[model samples]
Target: MPTASSVIEIPVPADQVWQLVGGFNSLPDWLPLITKSEPGEGGRVRHLTTADGGVIVERLQTFDNVARTYSYTIEQSPFPVSAYLATLQVEALTESSAKVTWSGVFTPAAGTEDAAVEALFAGVYNGGLEALRANFPA
Candidate 1:
């Protein structure tokens, strides 16, 4: 399986960041790549629509409100990967600072190279973090 992770620091309290991101269906609130996230399966699943009109469906795997963390798996997506498990977390660096990490592991599609998919997810994670950071200006 290929994996990718990205970490970013935001000049805001962890609780606040968590308040913004802890919701499974809140991606559209902060993630520019995701224009909308519609809930399904009693809110355990999310149907995401990208700004470019791409569709991705994912299911919530686990959630920890106290820990400010959540894990999810992709059920359908345009990305060339399968068995995708991803996590998003926020850690308190200080009373006024937070560190956010996004990571995932997946098997590349039959014809895709590991590095290619890794790079793709890495770019997505990194770019998404940058967009998240933009939400909290230093």
Candidate 2:
């Protein structure tokens, strides 16, 4: 399994960040790569059209308001990945500051290189974090 993680501190209360990230339905609005999202357990996310017009589907595994975390896995992906798990967590750092952690693990499908997959996931995760910063800038 290959894992990637990124952390960003947002100058906002945890509740505010939670309200945004926790509302999984609105991911496409902030995350450019997501073309559409259906919010709920077992909900799905569709990737935006890429140059190759590839498609991917991820299933919501868990959404916990108390923990301020959400988890999902790729139900259908174009990449050569046999399994994947992704999660986002929000932690209160202070009254006006919060930390967001995004991480994931993916086992490449047969004949795929783990390093390439890890790098791809790292880029996607980092981009998502950057989007959040832009959405809730200090």
Candidate 3:
């Protein structure tokens, strides 16, 4: 399995950032890569459409409001990955700052290059966090 991670510091309180990101289907609101996230399974599942027209289905595995974290597994996607598990966490750094970490582990799909797959996901995560930070500036 290959793992990729990205950490970003947001100039906002953790609770505030969590309010923006903690929802299982909130990706489209802040993530630049996702064009839309249609709700399903009573909001526990999201059918996400990427900006480049890729479709991905994901199921919320765990949601912890108090901990400001969530975990999800990709159920279906065009991406070259299998057994994808990803987590997003926000930690309070100060009264007006927070650290956000997004990470995932997955096995490279058949006929896919591991380095390419990892780089793609890392770019997605990093780009999303950068968009979030830009959305909420200090």
- Choose the strongest candidate by lDDT: 1
Top candidate (TM-score): 1
Model 3 per-residue lDDT tens digits across residues 1-138: 999999999888999999899888888889988999999989899999989999999999998899999999999998888999999999999999999999999999889999999999999898889998987966
Give the Cα RMSD of candidate 3: 0.9
In model 2, which runs have C-alpha deviations exceeding 4 angstroms? Answer: 39-53
In angstroms, how far off is 110's CA in candidate 3? 2.2
- In terms of lDDT, model 3 sits at 0.93
lDDT of each: 0.96, 0.79, 0.93
lDDT of 2 by residue, 44-137 (tens): 5533343345666667778888989999887777777766888999999999889999999878877878888888888888988898889875
Task: Output the lDDT of residue 62, model 3.
Answer: 93
| Steric clash count of candidate 2 | 1
lDDT of 1 by residue, 1-138 (tens): 789999999999999999989999999999999999999999999999999999999999999999999999999999999999999999999999999999999999999899999999999999999999888887
Taking all chains together, the TM-score of candidate 2 against the true structure is 0.86
